[model samples]
Target: MARFKTKHTEWLLSNMAITVSSLLSSNPKPLTSRPVGRPPIEYVNAGPRQKRKLASDLAVHQGHNTSLLVHAAAVSAEKSNEEDTALVLKNIYLTPSDHNKVRKNLFTQKTDSVRLTEDEAFFEFVLKIAYRLKLKKWQVRDENGKKEMAKQKNTIQKKMWNAMALHVDKPKQNGNGNTNDGNTARRAFAKPKLLAEILGLDENLIAYFNSILIAISCHLPIDPTQFKKYCQKTVTLYMSLYPWFPMSATVHKVLMHGYQIIEASILPLGVLGENASEARNKYYKSDRRLHARKSTRQKNMEDVFHRAMDSSDPLVSSIYLAKRLGQQNKLPLPADVIELLESPNFLYPCNMDNNNNAPVFDANNSDSDSDSENPFTIEIDVEDDF
Candidate 1:
C-alpha cells in the first residue's frame, strides 16, 4: 500500500509538469479576438440596420459602374432647368406621399428652376420642332415683320409662329385659349411639379407638355436631302441612349417619314419596301449581271443584326425578309431571332463559283454555270460601291 501510493504521487506530478511544458512550448497563442483598435461598441452599435446601411453603400458603388443606367439618369437630368435640379433631385428620392410637401417646397423655391421639365427634353428630342422649323415664307415673319425664321434657329419668335400655325387654325372657347388643337405657344415654361406653385388652376402637366408640343408642329419643312444622314445618326444615338423615353405619336410619325425617305433613297432605290423573298430573288441571285447579290445581302444582314441585337426594341430584324415577316405575322424564334439565317457558301465567292482559274464545274457537280461568274466585273462594282 505504501509503495503504490508513492508511485501514484510521482506519476501525478510528472503529468502536471508535462502539461505545463506543452503549454509553454506551444508557438501561437489561441486567438481570444480582442478588439483591433477601439471596440465596435464605441462606433455604431452592431445591429442589422448597420449591416443594411453598409450593404446599401456597396450597392451604390456598384450602381456607379453600371454606365448605361447612369447615362439614362444623366439624360433625365439634362432636360430640366438648372434651378429645378435640387427639387428634382429631392423629388427623385421621394415617393408619392411627399407630393404635398414637395408642392409647398416648390413655392418657396426660385422661379427659373420651376420652368422646363420633361417638356424641354421632349422638345430637344425632335430636332425640327425644338430647334429650326422651316415655315411658309408668309408664315415665317417675325415681330419686326421680316423673315427671321431661317437665320434665327432658336428664337422664341420662331416658336410663336409655330404656335400660331397650331392654335389659330382652331380657336378655343375659353378666352385664355387653353385647349390644344395640336398647337400652342412655343413656350418652354414649365411650372412646379407640385400643384401649389401652378399658374393655372387646372395644373395638368400633360397639358403643359402638350403646349410645348404645340410649339412644334407637322408643318415644319424637312429637307429630305440634307437632313437624312443627320436625322439617321441622331435618331440612332437617341434611341440607343434612351430606350425608356416615352415617344409621342407625332414623333413616331415624323421618324417614320424620315425612315421612308431613307428606304426610298439609301442604296439601291426602293429596296427597303420590296418583298424580302422577291428582293432576294431579284437582287441576290448568283447570276445577277452586275454583282454577287448574295454577298451584299449577307454583309448587310450581318451588320444590321450586330446593331439590332444591342437595341432594346423587340421588332429588330434588319434582314428585309425577317422585317417583313415580323410585320406580317410573328413566329417562334431564338433570342437572336432575326440574325442572318442564310449561308453564302452556295453563293458565288469573289465573282467566281467553282474552279478558281476556270469557271467550270467539277466532275462531281452539274450546276456549273449557276455557281460561277467573272470577277473583274465584281471588282469594278466594289469600287463603285465605295
Candidate 2:
C-alpha cells in the first residue's frame, strides 16, 4: 500500500541520517567495552558476517588495541631512509593487518569460560539474575531459540525494560533555559537503588544487584575504597548464593583481580577502551571498499598520516616531533593538564567519611547489642513501602 511504502521510506531516511551522524563523530575510547552489559536482541539474531563484525569490534575494544600514531610515524620515517631504491615503503611501519592479528589473538588467547565476548558475559549475567528472580515470562534467549522467534510479548519484561532505562530521554528545555522537570523526576531511575525501589525487589535481591552493578561498572564516580569494600562483600554473597552459575565466575574474577587490571594499565580505561579502535575500523572498512586494490593499503596509510598531520594543533605537532626526535624531556606537560590530573574532582569522588561506621538498621525491632554487632541491617519499612 502507498501508506506502508511512505512509512518504510521515512524509516529508511531516519536510519540513514542516524548512520551519517554516527559516522561523522570521532570514535573516542569508551569508559567500558562496546556492548558493555549485554548483547541486544538484534545483535544476537544477526547473520554470520554481522555477528563476526560485532565480535571483531568487541575483540578490538576489549584488547584496547589503539593504533600507536607515534610508533607508526617512526616506522614511516625509518622506511623512507632505507638503502634499497626499488623498495619504497608508502605505508606506516605497522600494517593494519598486524593490529587485526592482535585483536584476533585477544579473543582466542583467553581461556576463561566467563570471557564469552563482552555482550555474552553480560547477557549470561542478566539471564542468571532473571532466572533466580522468577522473571521468566520474557526470558533472554539465543538467536536460534523458539521463544526468540515468537512474536508474543510479556509484561514482566516490559517492567524490567522500564527499570533499565540507562539512557533517559531528558525533557527539552524551553526558550527561557529552565528545566521543566524537577530533580526528583530528572534523577536516573536506572540506578540500583531506584531499580530496586521501582521494581519492588526484596532487600536481599537489592543488595545482590547493587553489588553486581558496582562490580560491572568500570568508571562510576564513587569512592574507590568504598567501592572495593562493597564489591568484596556483594561478590562474596552472590558467589555463595550462586556458586555453580557461569556468570558467578565473572563476579569471582572481579573480586580477585578486576581492580588491579586498571591499575596496571598505562593510560585511562576510556583512552584505551575499544570505542576508538572500532571507530577507526569502521572508517577503514568503508574507505578500503571504495579503494580496493593491491596498493590500497599504502594509499590508505598515507591518507591517515596526512589527516592526522592536518588536524593536529601546532603545540601537539611540536610535542610529537620532540618525542619522535628523542627530545621529549624538553617539553613538559602543560600546567592545566597537570592541575586537572591532580584535582580531586577529575575522575573519582572523595572517600565516604562514615565508611567505617555501619548504617543503622530498624530502630523499632533491634536490641542494642544486635544493632551494634550488625550495623548493615536495613530497615523493614523500606521493603514494606516497596
Candidate 3:
C-alpha cells in the first residue's frame, strides 16, 4: 500500500503542471456587476418617448402592420430596386433575368410568338450541326480500331478544312495570352455538302442541310410551299435518327420553330445575315491593333474611328471593289443546290459587265459526279468498328 501510494504521488506530480495550465487557460474570470444608479432627468423623461419612436421607425422600415402605408411602400420600392440591381453587370446591358427570358423565348418551343433573327438561326443551324458531327463518339474497344477511327475522323476534318479554304493550326492566343478553345473557327470550316457524301449520312439529312444552304444563298424571296416541304422532311428525318440523342435548344429552334420565324421576316432571309457585321468586327480588331494610336484611349479611339471612316468611304471602297470581285474564282453550284434555290439566276448574274463572271451551274461537273461515287463512305464502317 505504501509502495502504491508512492507511485500515485509520482504520477500526480508529473501531470500537475499540465492540469494547472489547462485550468488557467479554460476558466475565464467571472464578470462583476455594476452598481445601479438613478437616471438623469433628460433620459428619464425621454426614455418612454424614445422607445416609442424607435419602435415606430422599425415598424415602418420592416413593413409591419401599421397605418403608415406610405413608409411601407417606400421600403418595398427600395427593396425592389435592390433586387433589380442584383444581376446588373458592368458593360453588359442585359440583366440576368432579362437574358434568361430572351434565351427561354429563343430556344424553348412552347412559345410560338418569339422568333430567332435570320443571322441567329443561320449560325445556330450551321454551328450546331458541325459541332455535333465533330464531337460524335464512336463505340470501339480494340486499340488498333480506336487508332483507325481517330485517323479517319482526322482525315475527314482535314478535308472539311480544305474545302472551306481554312488552315488548321494551334488555337490563337488572345490579349490575355490565353488560347480560346471555342469552335467558332471550326463552324466556319463546315462544308455539309462534302460531308454528306463522304460521311454517308442519311440522304434526308443531306437534303435538309442543302435546303438550308440554298435558302441562305437565295437573294430572292423564298417559296413558302417548297420551304415547308423541306422543313417537314428534314425534321422528320432528324427526329427518327436522333430520337435517343439529347436534343439541344438550337436544334429544337431549327427543327420546330424555323418555319414560323422565316415566314415572319419582312426582308429576304439572306439579306439579314451578320456576315458583314462579323467582318467589320475582324476589321475593328485589326485596325485597333495595327493602326490606332497607343498613347491614350481617346487618341486611339479617334484614330480607329477616322481609319474606319476612310476605309468604308464609298469612293475608297469602289476603287478596289472591281479588283476584289475579279479575284474570286468560285466553283459551280451543284445541281441539287440549284434545284433547292428559290432563284438560281441571282447567284449567276448575267448582266455583270466583267470577264470574271461567276461560274455557271454545270449539271455534269466532275466534282458533283464524283460525289455520287465517293469512296470515303467508310463512315458507316467506322461507326460499326466496335
Candidate 4:
C-alpha cells in the first residue's frame, strides 16, 4: 500500500513537471519521453535579458507550491494517524491521469453566471495570484521596494503603498470585459509568520487564511464562484490527509464549522460508483427517525456499522453494538445475526463462522478483485473516470 501511494504521488509530480516544462519552453515538446537530464534549452528565443529569468522563475515557484502541498499532506496524515481518522491512504492514489488533461479543456470556460456543474475556476484564479506574488518576491522587489515596504504604517498612504505590492492574478472585474487569471495581476503581500511551528497551527487556520486572502483580493473579491473553489481545496486536502472517510454526518459537521463565517451551501463530492445509492442507504449501523433519516455504505460493512453505532443513526446500531461487544472470539453469529446478514440488502456480514478469523481488508488490495475495503466508496470503472 505504501509503495502504491508513493508511486501515485510520483506520477502526479512527474506529470506536473512535464506540464510546467512545456509551458516554460519556447517550443513545447510532444508528449513523449527522452532520456533524462535537464531537457536542453540550448536555443534561446530572441528577447531581452529577461528571457534568462524563466528557469529561475519556474524553479522558485515550483519549489514553493510543491513544498506547501507536500507538507499539508504530511501534516494531515500524521494528525489522522494519531487520532484514528477514517479516510486515510485511500485518497492518496489518483483516479487516473486524464482528469488533469480535462482541466486544460475547461480553462477559459465562462458563463453569464457561475456554472453549478464546473466550479474550480475561482480557486484556480486565487492560486494564480499567489504564484505571482511569490514570483514577484523573486523577480522584482528591489532595494527601493524594500525601502517602500519598511515605510508602511497604518495611515491611508501606507495602505495605498502596501496595496501597491501587485502580483499575477486575474484582473479586477471591470464593466468592460472579463480578464483571465494567468494574464492579469493583482495587489498582494507576503506577511511573514512569527510562529516557529508554521504547520503546527491548526489545519483549519491554514484553510481560513487561504480564504481570507482570497476574500480581500480585488481580483477574487467575495464571489461565490471563488469561495466554492476555496472550500473544495480545503475539503480535498482534508480528504487526502485524514484517516477517516467524511461520512455525511462528519462532512456536515466539518463543512458547517469551517464555512459558518461565509454561510454558504456546497455541493457534495461523494465517492462515486453504481452502488453509491445502496451505500448511501444501508451501510451504517445508525438510527433514523430520531435524528434525520440517512443512508450507509455497502462495502466496509463493519466500519460503516461502527460509524452508525457511534453516531445517532439508529437503524442497525444495536445489532452492530451487539456484534462488536461479542467480537473478541466468536463463530456463527447467533441465528438473529445470521438473519440480519441474510437480509435481502446486507451482503457481507461479519464472517461469524470464520474462527479462522482473517483481517477484514488490507490497503494493498485496492485493485483486488474480491471487493473494495472502503464502505463509502463507489465501484466506478477508473478508466471511465480518467
- TM-score, one value per model: 0.17, 0.33, 0.41, 0.16
Clashes of each: 1, 1, 0, 22
Which candidate, 3 or 4, has the higher lDDT? 3
Cα lDDT of all candidates, in order?
0.39, 0.44, 0.56, 0.38
User: After superposition, which runs of candidate 3 have C-alpha atoms over 4 Å from their true positions?
Assistant: 1-200, 217-221, 240-242, 289-295, 329-331, 345-386
User: Which candidate number has the best lDDT?
Assistant: 3
Worst 10 residues of 2 by lDDT: 177-186
lDDT of 1 by residue, 232-349 (tens): 5545654553444445554554443543643454342223332444545544333344432336777656555444344323423222333343355322221111111122234212
* Overall local distance difference test of candidate 3: 0.56
lDDT of 4 by residue, 100-169 (tens): 6546656855547633111123323323223332233423357765554333312323333344432322
Residue 140 Cα positional deviation in candidate 2, in Å, after optimal superposition: 15
Please provide, for model 3 over 1-386, each residue's C-alpha lDDT reduced to its tens digit, 9 standing for 90 to 100. Answer: 98888879877567443456645777777879886895444533667888788668777787775434434444565576854433332112433356676677668656244454433344344433433453353335677666665666566457656665443332345422112122433244144555455444554575566556556445556655566677677777876865434555655665566667668978776678765678799889999999999999999999999998999877667555645655656544444445445676765553432343324544343243232332322234345666
Candidates' RMSD to native: 24.3, 34.3, 24.4, 33.8
Segments in model 1 whose C-alpha atoms lie over 4 Å from true places: 1-185, 189-223, 259-386
Q: Candidate 3: how large is its RMSD?
A: 24.4
For candidate 2, the TM-score is 0.33
Rank order (by TM-score, best first) = 3, 2, 1, 4
